[model samples]
Target: MNRFEDKIAIVTGAASGIGRATADRLRSEGGTVVGIDRDPVDDVDMAIQLDLLDLGAIAPTVAQIVDAYGRIDVLCNVAGIGHFARDEDETPEAWNRVIGVNLTGTYFMSQACLPHLLESQGNIVNTASTAGTNAQAWSSAYSASKGGVIALTQTMAITNGRSGIRVNCIAPGGVETPIGEQFTPPEDVDLTLMAGMLPYHRPAQPPELASAFAFLASDDASYCNGIVLRVDGGTMA
Candidate 1:
């Protein structure tokens, strides 16, 4: 059970949802977790308050991690934003916000972490979404961002595989989270975006997705570089 025993990990969006669950799962499995979030988080070995969109702050935060831990074994890019908006309803700011955090943030965070990761021969786990693989109805920005994540994950895996670093992505379908509490998409959007496009009628729990993340990041998946693991409960099948 302690696959990550004594290892060091960085998980973004650890304040809630899939990121929170990932941090918890890694800690429970005996990893030293440094959680990054715009808000505060509990139950992590270290918590760093950070907004992923603030690209200027990224290098310093990664440097702090290296200074504190000496090395990093895992990087989980899970911080992201999502909402339902039609193409016409999507303003320039609205489009920028989602893509900024979900795509740009992930890329820069990985960029900042790569030097250390290369030194440690570590791996990365990025959170993509089923929306990226298929039509996600009204949430065009979320889908596009996730699709970019898939591409980025693959590119990193290919680029770093020779350096003994593995990179993979996880594509989750609809999941229950704090965001669900206020999720009222535009009336014209398909309701399935809130539910899921699968026989399993309920949204997945954050922990369910977190488990897959752990597997991908662990030594058990040493051969899984560049793989896009879909934890979608058959939504894409």
Candidate 2:
């Protein structure tokens, strides 16, 4: 179980929820985890206060991690934001922010970490959502961002797989997280349109998703590249 005995990992959105859980999981299994968040993070070997929206700061942040750790074995792009709004009520600013944080941030962070990952022959696990594959009401921006993440994950996998780096994504269903708590459907939302979006069981907890993240990042999945592993409870079924 010491799969990460000498590994170093960077987990984004690590202040709470799945990010925090993923950091804990990797650390528990013997990895040194550097946690990143716009808010303060805890229980990590390193805590980096960063807003993924500040794209300009990403490379410097990655550089700082490489300087301290000398290498990075894993990069978990888990930081994201979303809220439901009627299509007519959604603002361009809101859409841009979601795409900026979720999609653009993931891409640039991967780009920043690529050289080190190439040197270390490491891997990346991105957090996409089941919403990316399945349509839901009041989720145009969220869906677009996650869908982009799915595509980005695959492209990176293809682009880097031969270079000794693995890239994979997890498309999770409803997870009990801060972002989920704040997801209020538009007042006039149609319930029936979302009926199929519900999972077969209760929403997954953060640790469950974290476990999947760990699996994808571990050597155990050395062959699991360019894949979107759906941790949804058969919602897509």
Candidate 3:
């Protein structure tokens, strides 16, 4: 349980859901976690309120981490925004917002943390989504952004593999989280058909997916790199 003892981790989107779960798990396992998110959240060693879409804040934030922890052993790029816009209604702003936070934000965060990770020869885990591999109605922007994340993960793995830094991604299906709740169908939407379409007939819990992130970020997955581990509860199967 103390697998991460003495390790220092940085988790984005740590204000809630899977990010929160991962932060808590890491802390419980004896790691010092620095949580980053736009919204305010309690229960972390250090909580920084900053919008991931703002590239200007990334370097300073990473610098702050290095100043405090001296090194970052794990970086979890989990900050993201979802979209459910109709095809014609999708604006450039919407597309940019999703891609900015999900893809670009991941890139900046990784780039900022790479130096410290290189010093420690640590790992990076990105939170992709089933939408990256599978199609989702009304979520083209979100899907494309996540797909970019997967691609980035692979590129990082190949480029950093020899450097002793592992990079991997998690593609999660529908999970019970604040974001998931936002995507839930309205009262007019029929649940019967939706339930029938999914293999699990329900969404996954945040902790269930958090455990996967824990493994991917830990030494147990030392050989895992450039791979997208799906945590969809058979929904993608």
Q: Tens digit of lDDT per residue, candidate 2, span 1-237?
A: 888899999999999999999999999999999999999999999999999999999999999999998999999999999768888999999999999999999999999999999999999999899889888789899999999999999999998899989999999998888897657778876778878778877888999999999999999999999899999877786
Q: Whose lDDT is greatest here?
A: 2
Cα TM-score of candidate 2: 0.98
- Tens-digit lDDT track of model 1 for 125-210: 99998878887677788889989999999999998899999999999877988865433578666666655544365679999999
lDDT of 3 by residue, 57-80 (tens): 999999998999899999999888
Would you list the C-alpha lDDT of every candidate in the order shown? 0.89, 0.92, 0.88
Q: Which candidate model has the greater lDDT, 2 or 3?
A: 2
Number of the top-ranking candidate, with TM-score as the measure:
2
Pull out the clashing pairs in model 3.
Answer: none
For each candidate in turn, the TM-score is 0.94, 0.98, 0.93
For model 2, the local distance difference test gives 0.92
lDDT of model 1 at position 64? 94
Model 3 — which ten-residue stretch has the worst lDDT?
A: 181-190
